[model samples]
Target: MSQTIVALDCMGGDNAPGEIIKGGIEALKENKDVFLKMVGRQEDVNRELEKYDYDKTRVEVVNATEVIETGEPPVVAIRTKKDSSLVKCMYMVKHGECDALVSAGSTGATLVGGHVIVGRIKGVERPPLAPLIPTEKGGALLIDCGANVDAKPSNLVQFAQMGSIYMENICKVKNPKVGLVNIGAEEEKGNNLAKETYQLLSNLEGINFIGNIEAREIPEGKADVVVCDAFVGNVILKMYEGVGGVLLKKVKGTLMTSLKTKIGALLIKKELKETMKTFQMDQYGGAPLLGLKGLVVKTHGNSKAIEVKNSIIQCISFKEMNINDKISKKLAVKKEN
Candidate 1:
C-alpha cells in the first residue's frame, strides 16, 4: 500500500484532458499514496498538466493518440482503436502496470475493455457494475447497473455474493442485507428471473439475503445490496438519479421563491448543505466493474474534476483491501460449499 498506481483515461470524457488531469492532480494532493498514470494525447495532456502544481515524480503522462467517441461501437472501438486513451489505460491495468483504471469514457467501451482486455475472474459467470446509491440509512450497492442485461439467475446470485463482500469491506456495512429487486415483497410475485433468483439467494450461504424489495422501498434503505439484471438495474439507477436531481432542484427553487423563505434558508443553509452532501453520487466515486482480474471503474461520461478525483482515490482502497483477491477466494469457497 505504499503507492497505488491508477491509469486514468484523460481523453475519454466530455471534459477531456482538462478536467480529467485536474482530477488526477487533486487525487494526488489528497492521497499522498496515489500515483497517477495519465493517458491521452501528449500535447493535450501536457498542456493540462502544466496548469496543476503537484509532485512531479508521482505523475506520469502516457501518450495515447486516438480517442474513443461515445457513438462508436464499443467492441469495434476496443479492437480498432489500439492507441485510444481508454484502451491503453485498460491494458495498463491488465498487464499489472497499474493496480486499477478510472474512466469517464463510454460505458460500452469500459465494459467491453474490462471483459475483453482485463478479463473476468475465473468461476465468475458475469462481472457486475456495482455502484453505491445513497439511501436513508446510508448507501446501497446496486449490482449489474449496466452490465449483463440478460443475466441469468445464477448471475444475480453471484451479484449478491460479490456485492455483500463489497459492502462489508469497502462500505464497512457488516453482514450487509441483500435484496432482490422485484415488484412485490412476496417470493412468488416476480417473473421467472426474479423468482428463480430469489430462491437461489435464499439458500445461498455467507450472505444475508432479504426477501423481495419493492422499488419504493429502495430509497428507505431497505437493503444494502440490491440485485437485478442490467436492464432493470439501469432503469432503476436512471430513475433514481432523475428523481433525486428534480427533487433537489425543486427544493432550491422553493428556497429562493420568496424573501421570507430566503431568510429562513439562510438560517439553515449550512446544515442543509451538509445533509445534501451525503446524498451526492459523485462522493461515492465511480461504479466498479466487480469480479475482474484488475479493477475497472466507470464514471459518468460528463464527469468533472470531483468525480474523477474521487474515482482515483477509490482505487487505493480497492488495491489496499485486495478486493479482487477477496472476490476470488469468496467465490472459490462458495463453489466448494
Candidate 2:
C-alpha cells in the first residue's frame, strides 16, 4: 500500500510542538502506512521529537519560521504570514507534497487557508466543517459546524449531500439518515432558511432525508447526519461539549460526596468508565472541512496528545477511502442533472 503522507502543523495548538509532536509519534507507532511531514520551527520540533523513540524514516521536519497566533485576522494572516506553520503546512497539501494537513491552529486561519490554498472540490457550492458527535446510536455527523455562518439554501443541501458521503465512506455508515436541525420535528416549524432548506434536501437525490431533528433529540441519535447553517451548528456543537463536561464533573462530584456513594461508585466504576468513553469527543478526532480538494482536519486549539494522535490517524481513513474523488464525482453528477 502507498504511504499516506500528512503535513502536521506542530506549532499551531495550545500544547504546540510538544503535545503535537507526541501525537504524531503515537500515530506513527500505530499506523505503519502513515508518514508525517512535521511543519514548524526545526529546532523546537526536533526537541520534542527527540523525546520519543520513533521510526526516524517515517517522520521528517519541514521548517516554518513564523507562527500565526489565534487572535490575528485570518485573511490578513494567511496573506502576510507566508512563513507561518499553518500556511506552510497548508501549501504542502496544495502542492500535492502531502495527502492531508492537520492543524489545531486558529480556526479562522485554517478555514481561510483551506479555501485559498487547498481549494474546494469542483462543483461544491460551499465546504462545511463536519464533526462527529457521540450519540445514543453511536455517533452523528454535525455539518457546517463553523465554516459558513450565513449559508444559502443550496449550501445546506450541499452540506447534507457532502456530509452523507463522508459518514458513509469514512465512518462506514450505510445509507446514513440525514436530518435538518430545527426547533421542532414538524416540516413547517423553522424559519425561511429551514423551510427552504428542507424542501431542497427532501428533493435531493442519493441521500436519505429524515425530516427535521430537534436539538433535544440529537442525543438520542435520531439521524446520522445533522445539517444546519454554521451559526446554529456551532451553537449546538459548543453546547454539546460544555454540557457533557459539566455533567461528567457533576457525576464525579456526586459519587464522591459520601462514604456510601463512594462505595457504590467503586461497584459501578468499571461499567461507568466504559459507558462514559462512548461520549468522549476526542475519541472521534477532529472535524474535517469537507468538499475541499485536499483533506484539512481542524482539531480543538486546546487539544492534547490523544486528540492530536486521533486527528492524524483520522486522515489515514480519509486518504484510503479517496473521499475527495467520491465527493467530486457526486457533485459533478448533481450538476449534470
Candidate 3:
C-alpha cells in the first residue's frame, strides 16, 4: 500500500500543540501506512512528541516560528506569516511534500491559504468548502458552507457538480440527489441567484438535480448534495449546529426532570447515544475546500483529539480514493461534452 503523508498544523486550533500532537500520534499508531510531518515551534513540538510512543520514522517535526491567531486577517496572515505552521503546511501540500493538510485553525486562514498557496484545479472557477452534514438518510454534502459568501450563478452550478462527485466518491452515495436551497419548491420562488442557479443545475448533465429544497427539508435529508451559495449555506449550517445543540440539551433536561423519565432515559441510553453519535460533525471529520490542488481540511476551532484524528484519517481516504483526480476527470468530461 502506498503511504499517505499528512502535514499537521500544530499551533492552529484552540487546543494548540498538545491535542494536535496527540491526534497525530493516535492516527500514526492506528494506520501504519500513514506518515505525519508535525509543523510548529521546535520546542513545543518536541515536548509533545516525547509524551507519545510510536514508530519514530513515521513522524517528522518541522519548525515554524510563527502562529497565526484566529483574530488575524486571513489573507494578510497567509502572506505575512511566512514561518507559521499553517503556511508551512500549505506549502508542503503545494510542493507535493505532503498528500494533505488537516487543521483546526482559523477557517478564514485555511480557506485563504488553500486558494493562495495550493491554487485551484484547472477550469475550476471557485473552490467551495464542502462538509458532510449528518441527516436522517445517513448524510449529505453541504457545499460552500462558508467559503464564498457572494457566489455567482455559475459558481453554484459548479458547487452542485463538485458536491455530487464528493458524495459519490467519498461518502459512497451513488447518483446523489442534488437540491438547490431556496424559499419555496416552485422554481420561480427565490432570489435571482437561486432562480438562475436552479435553471443551470437542472440543465447541467452528470448531476442528479432534484429541484428546490427548503431549509426544513435539509434535516429530513431531502437531498444528498445540497447546493447553495456560501451565504445561505453558512446560515443553514449554523442553524443545524444551533438546533442540534438545543434539542440535545432539551432532551437531557427533560429526562432528568423526573425520576420516571430518568428511568426511561436509562433504558434507552445506549440506543439514544448511538443515534446521536450519527449526527456528530466529528464522525465525518472536517470540511474539505474542494478543487484545491491538494486536500485542505478545516475542523472546528475547538476541536479535540477525536476530530483531529478523524480528519487525518479522512485525508488518507481522500488520497486513496483519488478524489482530486476524479473531480478533475469529471470537470474535463463536462467540458468535452
Candidate 4:
C-alpha cells in the first residue's frame, strides 16, 4: 500500500487544535491507510487530542515556535515565523514529507505560501484557488476565486486550461465545457481584459471554450468550469453564500411562525431539508488551489469540525488520483517547445 500522509496546520483558524484534532480523528477513523502530521504547539495539540480515541500511532504532533495571526502580512509572517506550524507544514509538503497540506487559516497566508513557498508549476503563470460553488444542477468549479484579483488575458486563458485539466481528471467531468464570466454573450462585451481573453480562449485548441456565460445562467449550470479573474470570482462566491443564507433563514421563519405552517412544514420538511442539503456549502468542504506543486487545500476560516473532516477526506481523492504528478506532466509539456 502507498504511504499517504497529510500535513495539517493545527495552530491556525478559530477552532485551532480542537476542531483540527477532531478532523484528524475523523479522517483516520474513516480511512485506515491515511495518516496525519498535526503541526502546532505540542501541549495544545495533546490537550485537544486527549478527547478522542483515534489511532495515536497514526497521528503525530510537529511542534512550532509561533503561530501566524490573521492580522499579520502573509510574506512577513512566513519569513519571520520560520518555525511556525503554518510555515513548517508547508515545508513538509514541499520537501516531500507529505502528500498534501490543509489549512483553515488566513486565506492570504495560504495562497501566498502555496505559490511562493511551495512554488508554482513549471509553466503556470498563476495559481488559482478553484472552489466548488453550489448550482441549481449541483455544483461547479470557480477558478481564481481569490488568488490574483487582477489577472491578464493570458492568465485567464491559462486558467481555462488548468481548470479544464482539473474538471476532467479530478472533478470527473468528461470534456468539461468552459465559460468566461462576462457582462454579455456578445464578443464585443466586457472590458479589454475579458475581450482579449475571449480571443485567446476562442483560439485555444485543447479546451471546449463555450462562449461568454452571463452571471444569471450560473444557477442553471450552463458550464462545467467557470473562469474569471479573482475579483469577479470572489464576488460571485460571496454572493452565492449570502443569498443561500438569507433564503434558508426566510424559509425557516415562515415554517415556524404558525401552527398551520408548522404542520405543513412537517409534511414538506423532508423534501425541503434534502433540497437545502443539496445546496449546502459546508458539505462541499474547501477549495483546492490548482497549479501548485503539491495539493494545498484552503478551508474556510469559519469552518467547523464536520467541514474540516470532509476537507481532509477530500485529500484522499487527490492522492488516489495522483493529481500532482498529472499537473506536473502538463506543466512540463507546456514548458517544453
Candidate 5:
C-alpha cells in the first residue's frame, strides 16, 4: 500500500500542540500506511512527542515560529505570519510535500491561505467549503458552508456540480440527489439569486437536481447535496450544531430527573449512546474546501483529539480517491463542451 502523507497544524486549534499531537499519534496507530509531518514549534512538538511511544520514523516535525490567533484578520494574518504553523502547512500541500493539509485554526486564515497559497483548480470559479452533515438517510453534503457569502448563480451551479462529485466519489452516495436551499419546494420560490440558480441547476447536466428543498426537510435527508450561498449555508450549519448540542443536553437532563427515569436511562444507555454518536459532527471530521488545487480540510477551532484524529485519517481517502484531480477533470470537460 502506498503511504499517504498529511501535514497537520499542530498549534492551530483550541487544544493546541497537546491534543493535535495526541491525535496524530492515534491516527498513526490506526493506519500504518500513513505518515504525518507535524508543523509547529519544534520544541513544543517534540515535547508532546516524548509523551508517546511509537515509530519516530513515520512522524516528522517541521518547525514554525509563529501562531495565527482567531482574532486576527485572515488575509492580513496569512500575509504577515510567514513563519506561522498554518502558513507552513498550506505550503506543504502547495509544494507537494504532503497529500493534504488539516488545520483547526482560524477558519478565515485557512480559507484565505488555501486560495492564496495552494491556488484553485483551473476552470473552478470559486472554491466552497463542503462539509458532511449527519442526516436521516446517512449523511448529506452541505456546500458553501462558509466560503463565499455573496455568490453568483453560476457559482451555485458549480457548487452543485462539485458537491455532487464529492458525495458520489468520497461519500459513496450513488447518483447523489441535489437540492437548492430555498423557502419552498416550488421552482419559483426564492430570492433573485435562488431563482436564477434553480434554473441553472435544473438545466445543468451530470447532477441529479431535485428542485428547491425547504430548510425543515434538510434533517429528513431531502437531498444528498444541498446547494446555497455561504450566508444561508453557514446559518443552517450553525443552527444544526447548536440545536444538536442543546438536544443532547436536554436528553441527559431528562434521564437524570428522577429515580425511575434514571433506571430507564441505565437500561437503554448503550443503545442511546450509540444513536447519539451517529449525529455527532466530529465523527464525520472536518469540511474540505473543494475546487482547490490540493486538499485543505478545516475542523472546528475547539476540536479535541478524536476530531483531530478523524480529520487526519479522512485525508487518506481523499488522497486515495484523488478528489482534486477528479474535480479538475469534471470542470475541464464541462468547459470544453
Candidate 6:
C-alpha cells in the first residue's frame, strides 16, 4: 500500500504531544495505510508514546532543538527557528519527505515558513488560507480568512476561482454557487473594495457567480463559496464564533434554570451536543493555507489532539482532491483575460 505519511508538528498546538500523540495513534489505528512522523523533542515524544503500545512502525519521531512560540513573528520564526519542530516538519513537506505538514502554530509563522520554505504552486497569485466551515448544507470553503486582508479586486477575483474549485472538487459541490460578500444584495452597496470586486466577479467566466450575499445569509445556505478580502472573511469567521459561543452559553444557562428544564436538558443533552458539533470550528479541524506549493494547515493555537490529528488527515483529503492544481487551472483561465 502507498504510504500516507503525515509530518506532525508535535509542539504546535495547545495539547502538544499529549492530545496530538493520542489523536495520531487513533488516526493510524483506523487507517493502516497511514504513517506519522512526530517532530518535536525526542525524549518527550517517546515518553508519551510509552503509554500506548500501538503499531510502532507506523509512527516515528524526529527531534528538533528549538520550539517556536506563538508570540514570535512568523518570518523570524521560520528563519531563526529553522530547527524548531514546526519549521523542521514543514521542511520535510517542502522536500517531499512527507505528504503533508500539520501545525497549530502561529498563523504568521506558518504562512511565512510555507512560502519561504515550501513555496506556492505555480500560477497561484496569492495563497489563501481556505478552511471548511460547516453549514446547514454540509460546509463552505472560506478562502483568504486572514492571509491577504487588504486584497485587491483582482485578488478577490482569483479567490472566487480558487474557492469555487475547492467547493466543487474537494467539497464535492458540483457547480457550486459563488457569491461576493457585500453590505446588501446590491452590487453598489459596499465599499470600494467590495463594489469593485463585485464588478470583477460578475464578469469572471470561470465561477458559478451568484449575486451578492449579505453576512446574514451565510448560515441560510445562500451560497456555497463567498469571495471577499481576508479582512471581511476574518470578521465573518470571528462573528460566527462569537455568536455560536454566546448561543451555546445561553442555551445551557436556560436549561439549567429550573428542575423541569434540567430534566429536559438531560433528555436532550446528547442531541444538543451533536448539534453543537456541527457548529464547533475545532471539530472541523484547522484552516488550510491554500495556494501554497505544499500543504500547510494552521489550527487554532488552543486546539486539542483531535483537531490537530484531523487537520493532518484533512491535508490528505486536500491532496487527494487536487485542490492546488484545480486552483492553478482556474488561474490560468483568468490570465488569458
lDDT of each: 0.91, 0.92, 0.91, 0.85, 0.92, 0.82
lDDT of 1 by residue, 1-337 (tens): 4899999999988988788889999999999999999999999999989897899999999999999999999999999999999999999999999999999999999999999999999989899998888888888999988669988999999999899988888888989999999999988998999999989888888899988999898889999999999999998888978988899899999999999999999999999999988887777789999999999999888889999998898888888888889899989988888
Deviation from native of the Cα of residue 29 in model 3, angstroms: 2.2
User: Which residue runs does candidate 1 get wrong by more than 4 Å?
Assistant: 265-270
Q: Quote the RMSD, in angstroms, for model 2.
A: 1.3
**Residue-level lDDT for 84 in candidate 3:** 96
Clash tally for model 2: 0
The digit string of per-residue lDDT tens for model 3 on 1-337 reads 8999999999989998899889998889889988999999999999999998889999999999999999999999999999999999999999999999999989999999999999999878899998888888888899888668889998888888889888888888889999999999999989999999988887888899999999899989999999898988888889988988999999999999888999999999999999999987777788999998999999888888888888898888899889899888888787787
Give the per-residue lDDT of model 2 (tens digit) for 1-337: 8999999999998899889989999999999998999999999999898898999999989999999999999999999999999999999999999999999999999999999999988998888999899899998999998669889999999899899988998889999999999999888899999999998988888999999999998889999999999999999988988999899999999999999999999999999999998888777899999999899999989888889899998899999999899889988988999
Is 1 or 4 the stronger prediction by lDDT?
1
lDDT of 4 by residue, 181-284 (tens): 99999989999988999998898777899989999888789988998999999988888888989999999999999999999999999999988888877777
Alpha-carbon error at 303 in model 2, in Å?
1.7
Global lDDT for candidate 3? Answer: 0.91
Q: Model 3 TM-score?
A: 0.95
Q: Against the correct fold, how does model 2 do in TM-score?
A: 0.97
Q: How displaced is residue 233 in candidate 3, in Å? A: 1.1
Q: In angstroms, how far off is 320's CA in candidate 1?
A: 1.5
Model 1 TM: 0.95
lDDT for each residue of candidate 5 in 1-337, tens digit (9 for 90 to 100): 7999999999998999899899999999999988999999999999999999988889999999999999999999999999999999999999999989889999999999999999999999999998888888788999998669989999999999999988888889999999999998898899999999998888888999999999988889999999999999999999988998899899999999999999999999999999988987777889999998889999888889988888888888888888888889888888898
Error of 3 at 147 (Å): 2.6
Q: Give stretches of model 4 more than 4 Å off.
A: 335-337
